[model samples]
Target: MSAPAVGKRQDRSGPGTSRLLAVHLRIADVLLRLVQLHALWLGWTLRGGLVLGVFPATAAVAAIARRDALGRTAEGSWGELRRDFARHWRGQFRHANALGWILAAAGALILIEERVMRAAGDGAIGVFVAGVLWMLGAGVAALGVLVWPLAAHFDARPLAVIRGAVVLLLGRPLAALAPLGAAAALAAAYYLVPGLIPAFGVAGPLWLVTAVLLRGGALPAAPAAAPEPR
Candidate 1:
């Protein structure tokens, strides 16, 4: 029906796969709401619409994987998008528990960045605004940081993942500047969500995932052998 009415109409007075499904569905819904609320704030300040906006992109990739795993995106075009979104939403609970530390650490780093930028006489409004956008861009681009193992976790190739992971990781310092640049684009979102959005963006968790994925060359294919016995 509508965003607010989604979980409202469901009766919790039942038990079965339907109930589990309902729980998952609700979890997914809440996750999106969180992302939205978070993004809105960052959007105001940073102007890039927070890391959650990147959800559209991340969800796009994840949907493809889920579609492959479950066989067919039979839910029609719109239905497919909604279904994948719900699944991705529900999946964040895992991140909530496990990835919280990473996010917290990232927050500390951002604050440090904030103080440094602010002290440099970059103009309070300008630096604050710029810093927020930087966080948002960094969070999502950081997601790209994990693209290597993410592809692998979904059974991507070895050489490809290695090459891509290196590119993303090495490129991180440079790529991070976009979010920093986006700050000048807008500051309205930051005001709304405060630290929830771009302030406490997704960079930390993404970095975690990227590191894990790249460490062992976790791509689906076996890493190439030591060029055999010559």
Candidate 2:
């Protein structure tokens, strides 16, 4: 009787241990992927000479995240992932840069305006202008958060992609806001644990945005192209 009881206990523990190990392995796999993604982003961004590299690197990340979100990607080897990311980065170089520099200019302009406002001192007009600029900055941030994923998932020109993102933001504010909140939380986490920045910083937020957009069905089935800027 005692032997039988011991065997039953061992049987239960064996499956429990296996299950725990599986969960741990899954977590480790996810962490490894995030690390790979971060490394690729950093490498490619540097490869592009930083200024030219950031947008395409980011676009590549967004494309990969979107595919992963849609269940179109597999957990392949590291070499495979790198090749895939490089392909995306190269493919998106022209269009991504076009979109990216425009947004970067807008953000820079906002910063310049803020600095001028500060130098002007806190007058009534300055306060009002600052408030308006703040709102504009927030709008631009929201548009940016939505833009890359839209660009990645849809087959449209840069201007059309921007228009699509704007439409999605206005139409699905909650879906758009969800990723922004997640991004803020990730930023806070990176601040507390600086080491995470190298591993999960960019990929983490981009993955969250992709997942939210996919799960929420915020994207269109087939987006119609908008006219190019005249």
Candidate 3:
């Protein structure tokens, strides 16, 4: 009753069916949170918040995923969501920009290489560039699913977070594909019904990626608390 007194810690290991139910419940919560995040992203984006606000908003979504994974959040808690979003947005602003620049640069290189390959129209260098572009795209996908969660869950330098994500991907290539596969599916769904984004855009993909990372033990488990004074 009363939602377990809000912050009272409980055993995380539940029965198999309970765990399955919880997963489903979490997905429902994520869909709600996704609407909130998409609204924030849209509001900020409309104000020319592209470079300045995108990462912070994205970080907020990642923060929600992290908090929910740790069992520190409750459903229908808008105040908590706002607080978490603001905290993550401020803490991650600079790092988000750093990541944005890196991704932007990679995208530019891919476009430039594509143009060169088009102009060359079949050559060894063209083929090589195409391969490089493919690899870069793959790397970007890995970075997207890993980096924000890394930032949300750890207190590390931005570059360190990037390196850790890369290391994790290299060490567990198959597991790493979870996020990329989720991304591709989400992208396809969005392409098919562009309206789906307004309804369940980032949250769907974020939850999918976060679920994968949690399963892989990429995030540290929340520590159990000491017993309250009796």
lDDT of 3 by residue, 122-162 (tens): 68877887888788877876686778777777666677878
**For candidate 1, lDDT tens digit of each residue in 1-230?**
58546655454434566878999996674355335433332332233243443433332333233333333434444445545444444443233222323444555676676666676677777677767858764664454445423442443333453345456545664443343334322334446656644433442233234333333333333344311101
Ranking by TM-score: 2, 3, 1
Q: Candidate 3: give the clashing pairs.
A: none
For each candidate in turn, the TM-score is: 0.29, 0.85, 0.76
lDDT of each: 0.42, 0.82, 0.70
lDDT by residue (tens digit), candidate 2, 146-170:
7888888877888888887777778
Residue 216 displacement in candidate 3 (angstroms): 3.7
RMSD of each: 16.6, 4.1, 9.3
Q: Which pairs clash inside model 2?
A: none
Error of 2 at 213 (Å): 1.6
CA lDDT, candidate 3, residue 178: 75
Residue 203 local lDDT, model 1: 28
